[model samples]
Target: MAGHYVIAGKKIPNHILSMGFIGAYAGAYALYALKPKPAQPATPPIQASSSDEEAFIKEFLAKAEAEESK
Candidate 1:
């Protein structure tokens, strides 16, 4: 025989608990799936040129090194 649940003090079948968990999961999934998504920009963002990025990185490292020497 299935033992009584400690909290409820009743013999709850395993199948019932499994069904409850499945129902809860399905309900949560339905809520998430139906939620509206944020709008996206029409135009993509502009990126910096490779040369400009390299220059910025060099400048940053130079400043960091200068500060470390102080």
Candidate 2:
């Protein structure tokens, strides 16, 4: 929805979505060829406490134990 309009102040039809995609791909290609590749910013890794990981393990173990006891 963000880049779905033309700079000429015209509304774009659904069919022109492919054209927008091609233009973006071409721009990216040009950047790749002429510039040093940009480093992606790192996202913070999700940290789970040992207890939280254990809880998930315990849940699966409980299911297995219940099935085994049946």
Candidate 3:
């Protein structure tokens, strides 16, 4: 006698159960392969500053010295 599946006390044929399993796997794989990817974020453009770097450093140091003296 060949082996069979007993689901919910009902006898299911092996070939039918195998086909159902294969069909489910195929359908899941199809859905996974056809799914759309998320969109990539756009990066902002860099701008060149027109301000003087030396003046900025000097101003920062002056503020730090003033705060330390208090």
Candidate 4:
């Protein structure tokens, strides 16, 4: 009997079946080897000094409190 390609209860050509398998294998290898890197989280900008940070926080809190009172 001559060899036949039977897949999913259907008949196909041997070359088509072999090419399909080769393509699938190549796709899997590409995915495994060429996966994209995860994106890095954004870093906060550097502040000049602790005094400047404290002053900004104090002003922000004062403004927030004024808004709440209104």
Please tell me which predicted candidate would have the highest TM-score against the true structure.
Answer: 3
lDDT of 4: 0.81
Clashes of 3: 0
Q: TM-score of the candidate numbered 3? A: 0.51
Using all chains and alpha carbons, the TM-scores for the candidates as numbered come to 0.48, 0.32, 0.51, 0.42
lDDT by residue for model 3 over 1-70, one digit each (tens)? Answer: 5678999999988988999999999999999999998987664433336457656766777799899999
Give candidate 3 misplaced runs (Cα > 4 Å).
40-70
Error of 2 at 17 (Å): 0.5
Better candidate number, 1 or 3, judged by TM-score: 3
lDDT of 4 by residue, 1-70 (tens): 4457777998887777788999999999999999998988665544547988878977887799899999
What local distance difference test score does each model get?
0.79, 0.77, 0.81, 0.81
Count clashing pairs, candidate 1.
0
62 in model 3: Cα distance from truth in Å?
Answer: 45
Q: Give candidate 4's total backbone clashes.
A: 0
Q: After superposition, how far is residue 40 of candidate 2 from its true place, in Å?
A: 24
lDDT of 3 at 36: 98
The per-prediction CA RMSD against the true structure, in angstroms, equals: 12.0, 14.7, 12.4, 8.6
- What range of 10 consecutive residues in model 3 has the weakest lDDT sum? 42-51
TM-score for candidate 1, please give it.
Answer: 0.48
Give the least accurate 10-residue stretch of model 1, judged by summed lDDT: 1-10
Name model 1 segments beyond 4 Å from true: 1-7, 43-70
